[model samples]
Structures are given as C-alpha cells and as structure tokens.
Target: MPPKPGVIPLGPLRLGDIFNGAFATVGRHAKQLFGVGAAVYGGALAVVAATIAIAYAATADHLDRIFALSGDEDPRSEDWVPLLVAFCAIVLVCLVAAAISTAMMYAAVPVVLQEAVLGRPTTFSAVWQRAWTRVPAVIGTVFLTWVIAMVPILLAWAGVVALVIGVVSMDGGDGVSVTLVVIGILGALATAPLAVWLWVKFSLAPSAVVFENQGPVAALRRSSLLVRGDWWRIFGISLLAGAVAGTASYLIQLPFSFIGMFSGALGSANLSDDPNPTSVIVAMSGYALAMVIGQLVSQLIVATFPPLVTGLLYVDRRIRTEDLGPVLAEAAAVPPQYTG
Candidate 1:
C-alpha cells in the first residue's frame, strides 16, 4: 500500500478496491453525480416528450382521418404520409437526445472520478462544465463502442429471424432457409467473443477522453494499451458491475411499475361504459406518467454507476501500468484552495 488519501488506496487496486472505490465515489460525490445525471436525463426526457407532443399535434388531422376510415376503406397517401413523417422526426429527435445524454453521463463520471481518486471535492457546476466540454469526444467513443458491440447482437438477431423463417418454411420444404439459419447461428457465435473482447478493450476510451484530454481515436488507443494485458480482469469487473447496476435499477423501478399498474387498473374500473376518448386519455395519463418516472430513475442508475466503475478501473489501470499512484498521491497532499 502506498497511501490512503481517497476512495481507493493510492496504489494498484484489487477487485474489492475497485468496487469499494466506486461505491465510495458515489457516496462522497452523490450530489454532483446524481445531480448532473438527473439534469441531463430529465432534460432529455422533457425534450423527447416535447417532440412527441409536437409530432402528435402536427399529425392530429392525419391520425383522425385514419381512425375514421371504415373496415373496407383504405387511407390515402396524404393521410398516412404526415403521420410517417412525424414518426420519423420524433425518432430522430429521440436518438439525438439519447446520444447526448449518454455522452454527458459518460463524461461526467470521469470528471467526478478525477477528483474522487485524489480525495477532493467537486461541485455540480464544475462537473457539468468539464463534462459538457468533453461530450463530443465521449459521444464519438460511445458511438464507436456501440457499433462494435452491435455486430454480434445483430448477428444473433439475424439467426433468430432465420430460425423463425426456417420453421415457417418447413411446411414448404425449403432447405435454403435451414442452411441460412445454420450459417447465421455460426456467424453469430464466431463474432460474439470478438465483440466482447473489443468492448472490454475500448471500455476506458470515454475516461481517457476526459482524463487525458485526448481525441476519440487517441482515447481508444490509450484504452487498448491500458487494457491489453488485463483483458479478463477488466471484462469480469465490467460484467459484474453491469449485473449489479441492472438488478439495482430493476429493483428501484419496481415500485413505480406497481404504482402505475394499480393506478391504471383503478382508473379503468372507475370509467363509465360510455367513457369518451378524453376520459380514457385522462385515465391512462397517471399510468403513463408513473412509467415515465420509473424509466427515468432506471436510466439514471444504469447511466451513473457503471460509468463510475469503469472510470475507477481506468484509474486502477493507470496506477498499475504507468505508476500513476505517486502522482495522484502528490496531488492529494496539496490543499484544495491553494491548488486551485
């Protein structure tokens, strides 16, 4: 052990040290971490809600026309086109909001960790400002990593689709579908390990982008260098962190889900036989709001804790490989105001 200045010992860390440090980082800086997360994600939800509302308003006439069509009647292109355009616009806005929110959280975690590792306090504004500046680079890293991970996931889904097609075609005696299914399954299996390996290898890129002030590609290379010899360790730790975060998120959201379910049931029970559309909408609004709040809370946990774990892993990797412990120790010895 070198020194105990902060969340973790100022030395190469073990598994316990990394997890403890992650939890400690949250405990010490909950205000900054959760505050930024809430603001970013909450703002994203608000933006998405606004987009959906605007889209609905713009296409209200088209929707009404479509709904009014009789069983034998088909909607005109004009009736459907506006709805389709609005749907696409809403999807585009949602994707942009999700990407930006994810980037902010990724950047914010490392910004907090940078000080947490040195036993220093950070404020929400400081974290937000630092994270906002790094969002573009973090977005690049996150997008690249998502693309890399999606390869095998898409392959697996293709396999499932092929399997379904093969089963459907069995009645028609098509051997080609069977062959396609086999090939898809094999391809997915072959690519799955490579995807996992690449994911772990580049897991630290977002942290590197923030901590080292590196570009996305440079941060990726830096992460690969740091994770090269310790792939299994990092993979296992990341897997565990993801499991913990997912389980905790699910538990946290359960209450809201139950509340939504019960409220929706109650509202439905209270509805008259001839309830109007407006009455139905009002009845379901409570359920929709509850579910939205639950999802927001779930997303908050999923976005925050895993990044904190990964950020600390980034620090642990540096201390282990580059002897960064002494440098961090030295920084920790300085008084905060004087250093600032």
Candidate 2:
C-alpha cells in the first residue's frame, strides 16, 4: 500500500488523530519504549543527584577557603587554592555528565519511536547504536531550536524588565509606577504570539534531524515547511501533550509536599532547639524517593507523546508532499490483537 494523494483532513479531527496515534503506538510498544525511556531518565537523575552531592560535600571546605581568602584565616594558605581548584574540577565533571545524559535521552527518542512505528522490537543497544551516529546532527538541531526559541523570549523578557524598571524608578508617586506596570504588561502580552510562533516552528526539528537525517539548517527548514498552514493544529497537539505531562508531574509531587509539611511539623515539635541530622536525612530520603518516581513517570509520559506526534507529522508530510499514505499503511503493522 501507498499513500493516496488527496487533501488530508487537518482540522479539529487532527488533534484526535494525533492523540489516538500516540495512545495506539505506546500501547503496542510500551515495554520497549518505556524501558529505554526509563533507563535514560534514571541515569540522568543519578547524574543530577551525584552533582548535588558533590557540590554539597565541597560546601564546607569551599566556604572555609572563601573565609581564608578574606583574611579571617591565612591569605597565604596553600590548601585554599587546591580546594578551590578541586571544586571547579568537580563542577566541570558534573557538567559533562549532565551533557552526556541529555544527549543519550533525546537521541534515544528517534531510535525507539521509529522502531515502534516500524513494528519492530527495540533493543536498548539498538537505541544507543542508532543514536550514536546521529548524535552530532541531533545536538546541532536541538541547539539551533534553542537559539530560535530564545529570540522572542529574550525580546519579551527585555520588554517586561524594562517596563518594570521604568515603573519602579519613576519619579512620580505610586500612581506613576502603577501606570508603567500596566504599560509593560500590555507590551509583553503583545509579544506573546511571536514567542509562541518560534517555539512551535522549531519544535519538530529533532524529529526532522533524527528520522530524516537532515542537516541542521535543512532540518529546521523542513520543520518550518511541515508546520506551514498547520501551526494551529500543531500548537493544539503540543499544548495538549504539555498539559498532560505537567498535570502528571504536579500530582506526583503532591505526596512529597505533604510529607515535607508533616516532617516540618514533627521537627518543630520534637527538635525545636536543634534540628537532628538524622531527621534531616530522613526527610531528604523521602524527597529523593518522590523525585525518582516523578522523574520515571514524567519521562515515560513525555517521551510517548512527542515521538507519536512526530510520526504522525512525518506521515502527514509524506502524504502531502509525496503521496505516502498507502506506503505508510502497508509499513505500519497493526497486530491482530492490538490492544493499543
């Protein structure tokens, strides 16, 4: 089968189609995709935790050295320099670890998702393998998207900040500042659409680069072209996906908040004179557990939606530009017992 050439319906129906496509795809390939997504998220979270631990461990020594430098201790102390150097070195290592984690997680997006679309079992090794060669392109595409998205945000932020400053520094009484605040708010509101437009335009670049092997500029161009006349629908789908992910994260965090509140109450009652270290560790342990759970669930849900939408967008583009519907239908293997 191949895609039939005709006008593809991309109105209210499109959002439903995209959501259904994601649900079906994830339902069918939940194990493989979820596994890979989980591992990446866990690995990344570990890196973050390690970084925090390292920084915290250095805090006492670093603060001491700062005091030493300020002449409270020995200014000529040789230990201070080495301690500061070590602190900087650890920070650099943490940064590199974080970079590696981000690269692995996003690069895995295409490999696993595409395998699901092709009705193949995705191996963890296969994800690494497929993503390795595409790493540079993927990184570049994402970096470019960041730059593009920042333009409007930067502009809007500048306008808002200027407005705020102007209002705060105004020579008039309270009424003048109020007037300036209102004007700034209006200016920021006016720039909101451009911010949104840039965001949606480059949103699909990673998909273009990974699945299409497009060069950085070409990927962005392709994304722009694919999004043309489709921004509203794309925006709706993206917003829906974001809403789902955000709600899930918030719900997941609620338990930790409750635990923290109870612990604070307990500490205030029992350890009012001096908070116990054991108590602190116990509270932190609960927070850490909650964080891990949230990361796992949030990553799974977030990963599911984008690749699904990207696949749909890919199919849509092929149908429009190359009449690829029938080919996609044949290529898509819907198992007889498909529960997704």
Candidate 3:
C-alpha cells in the first residue's frame, strides 16, 4: 500500500513482494549482477583450468602409463602416485576457487540490493569494488553457515555408511554394526531440525555483513536478531526461492546437455578404433565446451537469484522490526548522483 518507489514497497513485504523484488532487482541490475558474476566466475574457471593444465603436464607420463595398461595388467604405485597427487592438488585448487567466487557473488548481491531497494542505479565497477572489499567477511559468514548446515547432511551420510556396513557384515553375530546404524540414524534425525533452524537463523548474515559493514560474527548475531520471531516465514520463502532457482538452473542447462551429447556422439562416430589422444580430444571438445557453458549459466542463476531474495528479506525484516521504511523512502527520493 505504501508508495512503490523501488523493487518493493518501502515497507514490510509479503512473500509475493519479496519474490517480485528479487526479480526486479535482477532485471534492473542485470549488467552489474551478471557482469560481475561472469568476471568472478570466469576468472575462477580460468584459474582452475590453469591448475588442471599444469597438473596434467606434470603427470602426463603417469597418465600415459595408466592408459597403456592392458586389460588385466594392474597399474603399479608409480603409475598411480603422480596422478593421485595431481588430482588432490586440482581438487584443492577447485575448492579454493569456488569458495572465493561464491563469496564474491554473495557480497556483490547485497551491494546491488542496497541500491535496488532505494531505486538508485549502480554500476559494475562500484559493485565489484565494494564486493571485493567485503569478500573476506562474506567468506567467513558463508563458511560458518555451510559448516552448520552440513552437520545434518554429514550425519545422514554417516548413517547410510553404517547401514551399508551393517548389511555387508550381517553374518557377524555381534550385531555391533546394527547398533551403530541405529545410533547414527537416530542421531541424524535428532540433529536435522537443529541444522535447518540454525541455517535459517543465520541466513541473513551475508546481507548483514554488507549492509551493516559488520564482521562475520557480528553479522551472524545481527541476523539472529532480525530473523527472530519470523523464522517460519523466512524459512518458507527461502526454501521456495532456492527451489525456483535450482529448477531454473537445471532447465536452462538441459538444452546444452542435449546438444553436447548429440554433438559428442556425432563427432565420436568418426574416430578410429585406436584413435590417438589428439583425435579423442577433438571428438570430445564439443561436449566439453557445451558442458562448460551450461555449468557457467547454471552457476550464474545459482549465484544471483537466491541471494537477491535473501537480501530483500533482510530489508523486509528491518522494515518490519526496526521501522526502516521511511528511511528507505527518504533515500529513494534523493537523486542517485546526489547521494552516495
């Protein structure tokens, strides 16, 4: 009912308002959102690619030996060690790159939203610089939240593993594995709700980090305050946003996957029975490129939309609990050039 100046009414918002605001933010700031996202993720991808290339170069001999092994001739330690080390190194590099990229995007969204809420325009350079400044704090918040949420998932995995072991060792009369399975299952079930609760409670931390310029722990405590009393509403909306983003990402990637599959099949049809590495690379290049493009697109959606929703939720909570609407409206009335 309030004056609609920006993405949402400068007041407490409903579920529809939050969702629409998120979409509006993306539409208005696509250049900054997608542009910075592409730069960050593209740079990460390049780093990962460089790492893989270097690793492959170093372990090329071991890889050749691996491929040279006959049907029944198992590889020796020398044949596996170099490749294993390279694989572990590559994995470590990937994880580091992904963490940094994700943290940057998370920081960037709230920066964009800060302007979006006030109907002010922002640029890619502004978002990029501000986001980069906050990346370390965002990384801390994201890592802590992830560790909290993963508790239930890890417990469930342990339960599954214990169940598998129990089934495999059923002939042993001690029944110890059965007891372990039961304990794991119960422990996982008991902790799952706690994990979900903690996750939602801290969901607004990244936004707080950027909006309030708070450190990770302070931002988390701030999120706990804002999300206090409205846990279910925040939880449901967050869940819906995540589901929507995930589905869209998957749908967007489907066509690329099909194209890659068909093109790879066609290309491989021309390969000889004992084709060399060059030929194999050429044949599979289309598939690799398509998959890469698909993954990039998917990552863009995953990185952008949910954070937008969460950022809006952070604004909504402030409007509701802290009476932030008039402040936002006042900001919206100012010319973009006049205000910082």
Backbone clash total, candidate 1: 0
Compose the digit string of candidate 2's lDDT tens values, residues 1-340: 2222212232222556666656766776666567766776677677767766666566545545555454454544465665667678777866675566555556666656665555556555666677767768877877788777767656766776676677677654677667766766676677778768987887777777777788889988988888888788778777877787678767766776676566555645554354344455554565556556755676577656665576566656556666655554565554322212
| TM-scores for all predictions | 0.90, 0.72, 0.91
Model 3 pairs in collision: none
Residue 221 shift from truth in candidate 1, angstroms: 0.4
Ranking by TM-score: 3, 1, 2
> How well is each residue in 1-340 modelled by candidate 1, as lDDT tens digits?
4798889998888989989999999899999888998999999999998998888778877887787788999999999999899999989999999999989999999998988888988788888998999999999988888787778769686766867676776663557666667777787878888888889989999999999999988998899999989999999999999999999999988999999999899889889986655578689888999999998888888998889899989998999899998999999988654221
Local accuracy of candidate 3 as per-residue lDDT tens digits, 223-286: 9999999999999999999999999999999999999999899999999998766578789989
Give the TM-score comparing model 1 with the true structure, all chains together. Answer: 0.90
> Which model, 1 or 2, shows the larger TM-score?
1
Candidate 2: the clashing residue pairs are: 1-326, 1-327, 2-326, 2-327, 3-324, 3-325, 3-326, 3-327
Model 2, TM vs. native: 0.72
The regions of model 3 sitting more than 4 angstroms off are: 152-174, 276-278, 337-340
Q: Candidate 1 — worst ten consecutive residues by lDDT sum?
A: 331-340
- In order of listing, the candidates' clash counts read 0, 8, 0
Model 3 residue 101 CA deviation (Å) reads 0.7
